[model samples]
Target: MVETVVILGAGWAGLPLAHKLLKYTLPEAKDGLKVVLVSPNSHFYWNVAAVRGVIPDAIPDEQLFLPIEPAFAQYSSENFEFVLGKAEHLDPEKNTIELVKNDGTQRSLSYDQLVIATGSHIRSNLPFKPIGTHEETLAALHSLQKQIDVARSIVVAGGGPTGVETAGELAAAYGGEKDITLIVAGDHVLQASHILPSVSQVVEKDLQKLGVKLIRNTQVKEAQTDNAKRENDVAVAQTRTLILSNGSTLTTDLYLPLFGVQVNTGFVPPSLLDSAGNLALDKTMRVTGTKNIWGIGDVGNLEAKQLTVTDAQIIHLSSALPTVLTGDGGQVVKEYKPSSRKMIFISMGKKYATGQIGEWRLWGWITAYVKGRLLFVDTAEGYVGGKHLRHASM
Candidate 1:
């Protein structure tokens, strides 16, 4: 019988791993390996484009959905399969996985090996969900587009990378007539990155030139939308036409909270994680205490930020998996090596971005063109064997 390798969550990490395993997996082994990718989404989302899509004239919706079938064709083998379902839980001991389909049906699958790559969820307490789910995100974008069309005030909460990039793209799209303000509870934006000092300085300058107001060290206590908004800061409450955090009141037609991201691991067993609720992994990215189980990407917490870090990790693990499949103990007798990792890449707009890589601060349009412009939407589609879609207005 052929051995099955099941990968959960076909997002950033799972898709690439399935592709590599199916393409490069050796067929010589009598156990002929089968690779299965499980996820509810038939298409992989190039999430980076969500922010840029806020602009009415930006990328179109048809271009975003990269159907998974074409990408699977690149492997050139029937050993690969796509399971359309949500992973309900994982059982490493039994080497089985539970899944729930869209129609409320449930099933169990046995696996010889497993990979967990379910990504994280957006974090916001504003009674609104993150702008990732297709329906919710599109609704938010449409609302913002309408606001922009009417020349309304735009207020973006949070000053992290997502917030900064979102504000920049929105400002660039609407031009100066769009009243934009970024409210950061922290002292400066991009503070989590090593490039914060210099990059924040330059980005701040650019934002100022673009007529964006920066409110620093201010926490927004309450946000209510009605005929008017009433905002309350620490020890201060005021009713005005528009109000935000930091004991200040300002009117804005649109309010977007880009505060933080929440990880959805409820489908996974708590025992699989460490004290911090992160998967415990060996140097080779295998689940420390579970045999034939591997964890990659954000769920793995592999000492790298989620995003592209998951890509490199998947490559690193997938390249070495063949050895394990053929080996006696199912472990790579030789060591595994990780590919080069890019530290951080920030997209300012259509054709502009800045990033840091191993003590080097790089600035250019290459990153934006390669990633920021379409967020690899067409590329992902092409990889998945879907017809290439046209680029949306940058």
Candidate 2:
């Protein structure tokens, strides 16, 4: 009998791993080991570029949407298949997974080996406000575009990269016609990062030049929407008047919330995840206490959830899976160690960006060209086709 390999959640983590597994033929492997990838989406999304997606002149959607067939066709042999559905339940004891298809059908699959890359989902509740999902995200952007089209006063909540990026974009695009105010709960933009101090200085100077007001050490305490009835549509209120923790209030025609995201780990049981419901893994990316199981990328409880780190994790973990398959279950095992490189790219709206490579800060058009330009959307297109995107046209 041939061994079976099943990978769940064909997002960033699962797709790459599957492709690599299909491409690499193990030396000690048995005659036939079928590889199966399970995902609701046939295409892979470049998550890092999601923020840039909201920009008016950002990369086109076709470049960002990658189909999985080409990737599999390039790397996989005849023994690989893609199941168009979601893994609803995982039965570790029986080494089986229950799948729910988009067409409302169901099935169970047993895998001799499994990888759980079922990435994170947005959380609805937090100290910060909520941003909508899918169509909601697009709708909010459209409505804001309309508001920014005419309104003079705009108040943005959240001081993180998302907030800062939005403020920068608005200032760059509509600064002459709009008054942009940025509210940060902390003292500086990108507060949680370890970038050089000069980066923040440069960012603030640019925002000041663009006439964007920076309010630090403040939080939105209360938000009242322009149309109260539409408040429900906005995850946090669709506010016109926003009251701050510092007892200050401002009235505006448009409000944008750039707070953090909520993780949806409910799809997987808590037993497989940590106390915080993040996938708990031993050093080898294997789900703790679960046999023939692995976890990677944003789904894991690891501190860094950036796409760069996630991609690295997937590459490292997938390389070890072939070794594990050659050995008897527990006797021969390989340990996995994560890398220590931290990289972040922040889009300052328009076509400008600031990237932090370790402790050094590199800014300007190169940053924009590298990531801020098309958000590596063409890379996504290439992944789907299983060919390297030599030139990703912006």
The C-alpha stretches of model 2 lying farther than 4 A from their native spots are 26-28, 74-78, 124-154, 228-239, 328-333, 363-365, 388-394
Q: What TM-score do all the candidates reach, one by one?
A: 0.83, 0.83
> Residues 265-362, candidate 1, lDDT per residue (tens digit)?
66777777877667877777888777788887777655754464554576577665776786745654344455454467777676556666766666
| Per-candidate RMSD, Å | 6.0, 4.6
The residue pairs in collision within model 2 are 122-262, 123-262
lDDT of 1: 0.68
